[model samples]
Target: MSIIVLPQAFAYPAAAVVSTFWLTAYQMINVSIARKAAKIVYPQMYAEKAQAEASKEAFKFNCAQRAHQNTLEWLPQIIASTLIVGLKYPIPAAALCGLWTASRFLYTFGYTSGGPGKRSLLGNTAINAIVQLGFILGGSTYTVYQLLA
Candidate 1:
């Protein structure tokens, strides 16, 4: 069996991955807190639409849960981009990953903030995440080209 060698720059991307994991945990904690405040019982993933419409607490909890759920949806791509692009372009990948994580944090906060127009509150935050993805994709493309060249 051949030993695989990874560059030291990989450390940065690895740390970014760890940060994303912690972010997930943090979002979970927010959901738990919101659930308690909203009296959302265990086994129910969300408040009913009518209940949420009638109760501010329920709306808050739903926002928090949605924020966490959205993060989970994007997580695989974040992890994959960080690691795959880091294989050949570690620093740039890590930078983009860090930005992506930060953007996600803001997006989650905006979603859970209980402000007007829940999603519209911080639409730019999503733009930031998308921009980071573009950069990560660029890095990934270069990495792939290098690997196959």
Candidate 2:
């Protein structure tokens, strides 16, 4: 059989693909954790929300759910955009993707453990805004904008 070879340049794109997998799994796991936490805290909740007033645990559970949902709503664009960009500047795409993943993790932990108004980095709001902008800007600068051409 002939040997298949990949260039050294493939390294960063490979890493970026791994980062994408990690991030997708992280979002899914966050949802699972949220559902399990809800089950533990409120056994009455099967598929629907509990009718009683929200408690601290409930709020924490909601935080996890929202975290997963927010990522689902936004991150896919960046992930796919990064893949497109990776053809040219894989390392930069990988770095930006990794940074976003890290920020999401911190946000998830701080929101679930501390409360609604906790700071994961300088401030959760600031961190979220920065990461979102980073993806849009990074993707645009990297190569996503090329698609428009």
Candidate 3:
């Protein structure tokens, strides 16, 4: 078996991968928080959902759940594209990865806050996420096209 040695140039892509993992874990933290909040605000043994909906804390918990769900939905795509795009385009990958990480951080706060206070941070919520998605998807697509063509 030939041992393939990746050079220092691969560091950036590796960092991109690590960054995504960090984001995933970070998002999970928010999920855990929301779960705990749901239990606290709606402490019915089997009516977590129903009780959560009725509680005044519903808005905050719901936002947290939504943020977690949104992260879950997008995570697969981000990881896939980040891996592929990072290999061939590490600079852009790193930048987008950073943006993705930062956006999730802001999203966690904005989501949990659930009020006008969080609204002040413009790109803190979604704009960064969209930009990250665009770059990751666009880069992945372009890389595939280039390879196939």
Candidate 4:
């Protein structure tokens, strides 16, 4: 069997992919700290029902958890698009991934700041994420098409 070789430029997007994991870890640590501050214990997703309804700390913890969860939802897509598109267009893929990661930071910080409404205080991070994903996905599609042709 022949060995498949990746172009050296792939390292750029590869680093971007690794950065997402670091971001994810950071979010997770935030959630852990928030959980402790809010007194949320293991096996519980959030504070007790009454605390959830009445406590700001509980809300903050929930937001931290949600931010990490949201990041996980997008992680596979982020890694896939970066690596796949990076095969042909490494620099652009890396740039898009970097922007996407930045948006996640904004999303988490804005969310964990106070309330759910505050999540958009920094900017419309969701839109930034969507736009970045669109570009990377488009590039990945083009790369696939070129490979198949």
Candidate 5:
């Protein structure tokens, strides 16, 4: 492998770690805001015995939503990054890595605010395409380089 490619190969995993940190931060902030909003809106409901159960359920739903968002944001990046490292395609891998991170951000914002479905769907599709394309291109390039060498 070229010396330049070596560092780029390492960057794929590093980018994944950065993406994970971003996702976790986003989740924490989302849950915190949701919990605060729920508490303010349903303080009386939370206090009343009959309404307490409903409040609890609401809280649980908020938590679940946050978790879902986190998963949606991080899972693709993890998969793409891992593939990049394993397949040895730094350029496409890096591009996909960036796409995964960007999509996750878009997805998180869209999901949190209940934005239009098209935004989230587009983001998801873009990330998926990047990962798939990376895998194909990286594998092919690696094979060709090996044969030529």
Candidate 6:
């Protein structure tokens, strides 16, 4: 039996799946925590009918925060995935994608917990940079490989 190497395009769908999982998981966790925090902070605020309306506003704030965080986390994945498709370097691309996902998880935890701002941002940014570099290198390598072959 002979094994065949699949083309780089195959990585696109896999990367999408991974990206979706990471983004969705992070957003869900953020929203969950935000909701819980709101409830804790405004316990009596939601007691009466008018008060419920006011309390709902707090929940909305949490939702907005979750959306903001989700958007920030998604930018790197979008860039990385595009590069993976263009470059067709599956192995390194996939590895970087995994690292990006992990870093986002750590970032979400750090951000929600009010960890040191510099440390959290630095860690997340480093991972984002690594993913970006992989994409650039992968594209260059693919270009060379295609030219040679």
Candidate that would win on lDDT: 4
Query: Which 10 consecutive positions of candidate 3 have the poorest summed lDDT?
Result: 39-48
User: How much does each candidate deviate from the true structure in C-alpha RMSD?
Assistant: 2.1, 4.8, 3.9, 1.7, 7.4, 8.0
Candidate 2 to truth, TM: 0.68
Residue 57 lDDT, candidate 6, scale 0-100? 43
- Each candidate's lDDT (Cα)? 0.81, 0.63, 0.66, 0.84, 0.55, 0.55
| TM-score ranking of the models | 4, 1, 3, 2, 5, 6
> What stretches of model 2 exceed 4 Å from their correct place?
1-8, 40-54, 123-127, 141-149
The candidate scoring highest on TM-score is 4
TM-score of each: 0.88, 0.68, 0.73, 0.91, 0.53, 0.53
Query: For residues 1-149, what per-residue lDDT tens digits would candidate 1 score against the true structure?
Result: 99989998899999989999888998999999999998989999999999899999999999889888977987887788789888888887888888777777777777888743655445656666575568556766777888899
Question: What tens-digit string does per-residue lDDT give for candidate 2 at 5-40?
Answer: 544665775676576567668766765676675554
Clashing pairs in 6: none
lDDT of 2 at 19: 69
lDDT of 1: 0.81
* Clashes by residue pair, model 2: none
User: Which pairs of residues collide in candidate 1?
Assistant: none
lDDT of 3 by residue, 73-113 (tens): 87777767766776667677777777776777677677667
Q: Which of the predicted structures, 4 or 5, would earn the higher TM-score when compared with the native?
A: 4
Q: After superposition, how far is residue 131 of candidate 5 from its true place, in Å?
A: 2.8
Residue 4, candidate 6: Cα error in Å is: 16
Off by over 4 Å in 3: 1-7, 40-53, 115-120
